[model samples]
Target: MSMAPAVDAGLALLILGLGLWIIAARSNFAAVVGFMTYGLMLALVWVRLTAVDVAMTEAALGAGLTGVLLLGAAARLPAEAPGGGPGAGLRVLVAVLCVGVAAALAGVVLSLPEPAPSLAPLVAENLPPTGVKNPVTGVLLAHRAIDTLLETVVLIPALIGVWALAADRAWGARPGALTPRPSSSSLTLLAQVLPPFGILVGVHLVWAGADEPGGKFQGAAVLAAMWVLVVMAGLADLPKVTNRLMRYTLVLGPLVFVAIGLAGIWTAGAFLALPAGYAKPLIVLIEVVLTLSVALMLGLLLAGPPKERA
Candidate 1:
């Protein structure tokens, strides 16, 4: 706390530099890499602000998962040729517009009222009913359960959109990765070595989230990354898009959540509300199912559409 100001200044400068470089980078890959770095750095900023839950989400999903997804896209997509981009006049106009927007945002942030109208106090006051010790988890699962439910639900449609891009003949086939199976011994070794630890850490994160800074989303991202790495190394294969078990597994979380939510109307008198005295168990059950479904969905999304038939 004593040296907070200096730390904040340094972090802010570093983030600003990363943001500028990401915008200025000529290559798409470079910009994506810089974006991932910026996300991780911003996670540190979140931590310094005493928001560990948000920091975990930022580090795991924003940086870790998104970085991998974009890198894979960069590998598969063709790059635009140099000088095929906007001309100087257009660039200057866009830069001016961007700067004006950034200045407006900064002004708004600076002008925000003191004693921020946050829901922290409300969440704290009602957290005990959720039967979870972590206030973030409580808010996500109990206080604002519908919002969280909708977040997971949206992933389903997004994945559907990705799969819809596949050729007709590829409808039932395994999805293609951003890159072909990498056979490098070093990559193979890393793929073989890292997953066990990654899996353990991922599970631990979900488990500890009940009372700590970690959570299902963060843990799910780690699990998804490990699966993607192994699949890319050719140690594992993605199931066909039409695989019955895989398809069912993808929807298991939301399906279960909906069932429980509807049951809540009878037992708890409100949709998405947990029955009294069983909140913790039900929440844990939902999280466990969600973790698995989310991990699979994310891995498959990163893997792209099904491979075209030969």
Candidate 2:
């Protein structure tokens, strides 16, 4: 008998177990660990569903970056205070609400049409004008360019929100360091050894995105993770909030995208519509700059608001 079903069943069980463990875990750190593992398993599930792009994104942002963020938060929080706990009634109510939400979601999913709605055929028919082989890329960059642009632009405000957490007096200062203690020799060594390879992989993901199951976001997440690793190991320090170059880097992606879109109105009669024969180059340029901006934004957000005077 084929073992694929057995393997899939095992994966499903493992994911469900992890979810329960995360909810039941007493320590914040333990819960964060379980959440990370759960994210990884979900990534695997995406892979099994043949959604490689989503799988990469899940592994990169959902598992890797989010896990770090939660870990940092857990580290910063104080230990549980004696006699300061949620009441059993509150817990029971929360559990009921969660179950209701889950059941509703399951019902909606199960009620989806037998064939399901899809724009894939339309995307394939229209993709050639966008000059990209990957249908997902064509859909994101060409067919839905405005949405992608808005998504990138939204990160600026999100980063600003993170910065708003700081005291006014700390406005221009550096963010809090990622870790409190001195780095161990092993961590330092891994920091040195891993970033080079990680960077290459990140770049490859962006470069290959035009025709493959990769994209700027996945690349940016990997790049951000490497930078975080370096900072966590004491090999690098977070930049000052008021650094001119850093500010420029943060805005570069969105600025370029908007500029390209404006030029398109004159050339193609529509904003964000790439002119014929130049689509691929313009798309590649946007991807590269967006990767840089996103990587920096994610890293800075994880670094938290400015905590020390410059």
Candidate 3:
């Protein structure tokens, strides 16, 4: 058998095993661990499917940051005594039901038309004017910019909701830290060693995403992870939700995107359309600002709702 098929087969089995393990886990923490592993494996599956952008997103948010967030939640919760859940018969019934659902999903996938329809050719024809070599970038920034713009804007209300969870007295206080204890020696060492390299990688992702399989979301997630590490290692503190500077950072991307969209009406006779020759510069400008804004917003979101320390 060729190596590619073997890899795919093994990946599929590992994913299946982890999914079952998560469902069967006796402890929430163990289930979270299994889910995280499943997420990573799914990212690799995305790569095998030739969707590296989706892969980056899955590994970064779905696996890495989410694992960190849930692990923190688990640590804070009272320990379960571990004896009492659905009995074996119910478990068996549930398993059968899950198998049925999975079978239905598989049926849906297999029933899809062969040689799936794609807009790749249409995107290619319009891509040169966008100045980005990445087709995904072109689609996001040029063809369907409003969708991407709104996606960024949506984070604002999410952060607001998180902040609203704070007690009225905690309004100006920082969010709860994900990792509040003094760092272990090894963790500190990793924190110090990783950020320089991590920052470099994040910037490269944003910069190259304009021409390759990376973009603001993936790059920002990497940057956010680095900031998260710094906080977890006790090297820095997150700003208060009410801080003027922090709020500005949160909205900067959406603000700039909206500005560009309005400018487009004058420059190109349509919202978010690039001028005849300035496509590259405008896209780069948007990417750079949005990267910073996105990194900040995601970092804060992972830190949870703001509240005063007792």
Quantify all predictions' global Cα lDDT against the true fold.
0.89, 0.90, 0.88
Better of 1 and 3 by lDDT: 1
Tens-digit lDDT string for candidate 3 (24-101): 797889988998999999999999999999999999989987887788778777667457656889878988998999
Runs of candidate 3 with Cα error greater than 4 angstroms are: 77-104
Per-residue lDDT value at 260 in model 3: 87
How do these models rank on TM-score, best leading? 1, 2, 3
Q: Score residue 213 of candidate 1 by CA lDDT.
A: 82
Judging by lDDT against the true structure, name the best candidate: 2
**Pairs of residues clashing in candidate 1:** none
35-57 per-residue lDDT for model 1 (tens digits) = 99999999999999989989989
For residues 238-271, what per-residue lDDT tens digits would candidate 2 score against the true structure? 8899999999999999999999999999999999
Clashing pairs in 3: none
Number of clashes in every candidate structure? Answer: 0, 0, 0
